[model samples]
Target: MENIDKRNRLDEAPFQYRINKDQTVFIDYEGKQVKILKGKEAEKFIKNVNAAENDKAVQLIMAKITGNFKRGNERKKR
Candidate 1:
């Protein structure tokens, strides 16, 4: 039953993000990470990212473009 869903809806915000000095970016979805980089490289990477990871990666990228992504943990500081 659980194996049915290969991907989840992009219903929520991104779970993680990272950017390298080379401008390569990475996003996390469902405990997995996907990388997006320079033109040709990015295209290839995107193809291998899988639907679920791609969804979250695109969501995070869109948030960055529109300035909607927020950083830091949601939990209260100890």
Candidate 2:
């Protein structure tokens, strides 16, 4: 696992970051991480977030962890 700086303390923090064995950084929220998933990760996350056990609003907090998610708007539309 790899370590990354967190905005708030673990208790106050909402998101968790993990570095997979493949050296890819992942952000954890709503019981899932934005890691090297093949398919359905994004869709699953959006679908089951409400069923997660996040007390401190992990979804809201995870949204702040934008570094893990790639920026799509950066690329020019075809």
Candidate 3:
């Protein structure tokens, strides 16, 4: 499962967090270290992390990196 936190949900927050060789991320929320996975491991991480606010943060990050945030159905309307 992915680690989803309130910070991740913010659109103003940075998306490309540091990439450590150890594959662990240290988020300063919840007062504890957190782990963020990449590549195939990311799929599992998504399942574990689920905070509504955090989800929005992640989506914004993805949208910014991808240049847009329209869902499949919404894209079709454009």
**Residue 72 lDDT in model 3?**
35
Model 3 bad stretches (over 4 Å):
1-53, 68-78
Top candidate (TM-score): 1
Q: What is the lDDT of candidate 2?
A: 0.47
Ranking by TM-score: 1, 2, 3
* lDDT minimum window of 10 residues, candidate 2: 1-10
Name the lDDT value of residue 31 in candidate 3: 33
Write one digit per residue (lDDT tens) for candidate 1, span 1-78.
123223443445534555567647565644456434566654444454444355556554433443433344455336
Query: Clash pairs of candidate 2?
Result: none
lDDT of 2 by residue, 1-78 (tens): 013324333454546655456544466653465544323554444444556566445444355434445343455336
Better of 2 and 3 by lDDT: 2
TM-score of each candidate? 0.31, 0.29, 0.23
Ordering by lDDT? 1, 2, 3
As a whole number from 0 to 100, the lDDT of residue 4 in candidate 1 is 27
Model 3's alpha-carbon lDDT is 0.41
